[model samples]
Target: MTDDEAGAAPDVPQEPVTEPVTGAGAGPAEPAGPAPLGLVRTPTGHPGVDAHLERLADADHLAADGHVEVYEDVHRGLREALTALDAQPVPAPYENRS
Candidate 1:
């Protein structure tokens, strides 16, 4: 084995099929028409949150795995942001007395 060849990174296996990610609640019985996210209030001002909702709304078109990965990526990032807030001190509320 040559020195350069032995130290090279290994090839990662990738699935040839471009399957879309779907929701975890979905199953083999619900392949045709996934399901609604059951969200009460959508179109929140937050871009990330709105994108996540849009992804969920379009989950039916996405492959089961793909939907899950996208969902996790969005929520995981939001979760990180939410958790980060706990570490920082909260600002005092403004008092208005007129």
Candidate 2:
């Protein structure tokens, strides 16, 4: 809450999400090569999402120097926030009738 950082955006984290482990070539790290994403940038039909997607698109260009890690670091807070906010409440166990 410093005077200079009053409205500064939260820093993202540097943790890669666990990728699916199907049979082969599936894990946390992306296989070394160009990503499958084809630089596709389209309107997400949502107001807030497009900016995020565009930022990701911009990030793709800088992935050579472990930019993905940088992204993970940067969006860590956002990811945690989303995960927490999206968590659903569990229901109580039903009791047997006497």
Candidate 3:
């Protein structure tokens, strides 16, 4: 091998490096916060059910570990609403006198 070719470095391909643009006229920087899941919650006709479902949104801003509390609260509320339905007193049938 020639002296020049022996001493030269190998020509390996490299990935291009990118840098964020800064200073005048750059678009607004992205927020350095957790992004919401953007899930849409449809409203249920029942207020109690709707409220419980809305409470689930609280988990969006929280870390994974914190989601349990929000989920548990929603679950408890929904369970209470269901239990309330069963606890309601049913009206007795009226007796008819001949």
Candidate 4:
């Protein structure tokens, strides 16, 4: 069995080495665009809607220094929209349903 190892021609099939691709539109390495799933409740602007549109355009819901401070501007616009939606990047809660 020495005739060039019996006319060898073995390793002849591969086609399966993928692992060099990348995220589509790989732009913005991650500027933020996730979070805000369920129960988000209002906050990113217009939540209190400018103190209910200035108390219905001056209908006066007791705002003449009567201590109607709109809960500190709706708690600082809901803590800056929950700190910018908790700094985005969230996705991991899908399990097998029974």
Candidate 5:
């Protein structure tokens, strides 16, 4: 070895290390797509209410814009369920005659 190079560290080949690119030109860090949260929906016992709750799962696979439709449908269904409860005939003890 040459006297000037004698004390220098030996050169070793290295594999290139890569890292995820970020910032303005890096684009999105993850896909800008809908992903499921894997949430579980418990049964509400009431079929109408349960059905509406189940309908919410559809939004998990839909883009943000599509969620509004699912949300509105669930809302409308739940509202109908509530209204149906009000439409039911009252028990004998609760009925009033003038």
Candidate 6:
């Protein structure tokens, strides 16, 4: 072994390396919209259902483009509609699942 290699300490603690801090426009860029709501891909067997899904996706994308408030309003409307649908009279339940 060389004299310098033999003399170096084997157990010394080294300074921890860190990633450089990012300033404005330095880090990874991101999409400028509310992330996708929980829409899942349905089986492509039904033509009518597939067409409806495509139309919904197109409208959602358009709403996301520089119109976040409108997108949120659509979300609210959807929620209200779902709530109203559930509130409508239904057959009596036999027992509570809870």
TM-scores, one per candidate: 0.38, 0.32, 0.61, 0.23, 0.63, 0.29
- By lDDT, the candidates rank as 5, 3, 1, 2, 6, 4
- Quickly count the clashes in candidate 6: 0
* Cα RMSD (angstroms) for every candidate in the order listed: 17.1, 26.3, 6.2, 24.0, 9.0, 12.8
| Deviation from native of the Cα of residue 7 in model 1, angstroms | 76
Q: How many clashes does each candidate structure show, in the order listed? A: 8, 9, 0, 0, 0, 0
Off by over 4 Å in 1: 1-41, 92-98
Ranking by TM-score: 5, 3, 1, 2, 6, 4
Q: Write the per-residue lDDT of candidate 2 for residues 4-36, one digit (tens) a residue.
A: 589765777878866678666555555566464
Q: Model 5 over residues 1-98: C-alpha lDDT tens digits?
A: 79558886567788887666787666447657898989999997998799899999999999999999999999998998999999999877765679
Please report, as a residue range, the 10-residue window in candidate 3 with the lowest summed lDDT. 25-34
Error of 1 at 26 (Å): 28
After best superposition, candidate 5 residue 65: deviation in angstroms? 0.7
Model 3 stretches with alpha carbons more than 4 Å out: 1-33
Give the per-residue Cα lDDT of candidate 4 at 11.
73
Write candidate 6's Cα lDDT for 1-98 as tens digits: 97669886677789997666555765455556654565876856655445444445544455446455554555665566567779999988799688
Error of 3 at 9 (Å): 23
Clashing residue pairs, backbone N/CA/C < 3 A, model 2? 12-73, 12-74, 12-75, 13-72, 13-73, 13-74, 13-76, 14-72, 14-73
Local lDDT at 73 for model 4: 55
Q: What is the lDDT of candidate 6?
A: 0.60
Question: Model 4, 1-98: lDDT tens per residue?
Answer: 87669997777898986555457844345444333223423433654544443433332334445434655555666677668778998999999999
Model 1: pairs clashing at backbone N, Cα or C within 3 Å: 20-63, 21-63, 21-65, 21-66, 21-67, 22-63, 22-64, 22-67
Q: What TM-score would candidate 5 get against the native?
A: 0.63
